[model samples]
Target: LVDHKQTALPALIEQLDSEERDHPIRKLAFTLRAIGDQRAVPVLIRAFPKTLLPASSDYGIKIEDPELKRWIAKHDLGKGRSIFSYLRAFREVVGALQQLTGQNFGEMELFGVNLANTESQRHLQREQFHQIAQHWAHWWEANQESHGVDPAYAKARVLMAGKKQGQLLDKDMRETAAE
Candidate 1:
């Protein structure tokens, strides 16, 4: 909190887990954002296990071996060696939030989607991705990540599972979508 107003810390932390429930990073960021008491920049720099980091059942993402993971950890995320470090971009995320809310926060911590008007689509896509993820667990649980089930079929199965579980769809929801 650049302006050091940690009063909103709780609400901002809540937003971290709110982006999309399936968003592991968001949840991780929740803790990180809270750890520094809303000062998010340093929280990530200390290797705080934010998201998938070559670990266990992280819901089907590939887990590289220890050595490979170490190699990956040492390297920055840019494929084409750009000057911008992931951490820098991360700070920008926090900075933008402070600007948009006009809530002067010192010790700047970044959370949430980019508030850029262009990024409204980005937020929508992020939301849709969570919806898509609601399907994955069902597909994996029922079909074992697909035993001869093609991608399209798997997707349909996910929708069915999500609907059956009443995740984001109910009888009325289905009717509304149909209309």
Candidate 2:
């Protein structure tokens, strides 16, 4: 389904947007990466912010005790984990962008930082995320029109053909060895 980027790409983007679940969104982002379409860049960028938020189910839990709620919020128990996941997801998106555009804007390093270890680290990581996202957005806006299409799409076809030829050669070799 991912290879058929003409249709599958847009559908996946819609799913990424509409689905509140992090798992589905992460799957869609990886699918888009596998598709290797330059068109997926913008969609991935838009979905980046969504990854930072805790799942809808997290909010649905009814906390009866105000003190507990305050403690949870203050310590960022669930929220910290969600942010960690978001950073990982954001890294994948940035990776896809780098692969598609052949540009490294240092986003991978920014996203890879271990922010969950300490509160100060988390603050720094959040600031870095904002900076990286802004940089990518600005870069995309400037160069979106210049990128014609996915270069990997053409390369993938070539690689597949090579693989088929290699398989045939291997089979012939096996037959010769048997004879």
Candidate 3:
């Protein structure tokens, strides 16, 4: 059996099925924290934020951990319950992904993101994502391996484009506007 400890993290990520990423190995790695092997550190770091150990007997991660009380007593994060540390942990994921991928991964929009108005998010109401999508086609042209990418979202984009192009069908309106 090949020892995964010696394997490159990128290769391990490519090899493991998504389920394997969530189970025993991920738990063990997080429990150990700094897994010492630099090659595996990237993979371990990616898993850390998501590894939800048994928070309490009641079992609801959204409810906050027991250590949270101790942290409040210390006043390190100020009063009133807020998920600041959780938000900060997310930045680590972004930082690591940026290091691994070069260029910012923040610009990329995954197909399955949760948003009330995905159309607006992808095009209309303006998120950082619209510019990313504008550039996505070009990125795809350059990288064939990205074919697994989700379908293009364009309803809001179409609306935004029409708005920008002048919301008038009249030839005179178009001509005058062009000038």
Candidates in order: C-alpha RMSD to true structure: 17.6, 18.5, 15.1
lDDT of model number 1: 0.33
lDDT of 3 by residue, 5-62 (tens): 3344344533321222234443334222222233333343333223222221211123
lDDT of 3 at 51: 25
Off by over 4 Å in 2: 19-21, 50-87, 114-124, 149-179
Rank candidates by lDDT, best first.
2, 1, 3
Q: Tens digit of lDDT per residue, candidate 1, span 1-179?
A: 32343555544544542332334443344334323332333222211112212222212223347664453233323223323233333333333323322334232322333423455664554444333233323323344332443343232211222133324433423443344
lDDT of each: 0.33, 0.53, 0.31
Among the numbered candidates, top TM-score falls to: 2
Q: Which of the two candidates, 2 or 3, achieves a greater TM-score against the reference? A: 2
Q: Report the Cα lDDT for residue 61, model 3.
A: 27
For all predicted structures, in order, the TM-scores are 0.22, 0.53, 0.24
Ranking by TM-score: 2, 3, 1
Model with the higher TM-score, candidate 1 or 3: 3
Q: lDDT value for candidate 2? A: 0.53
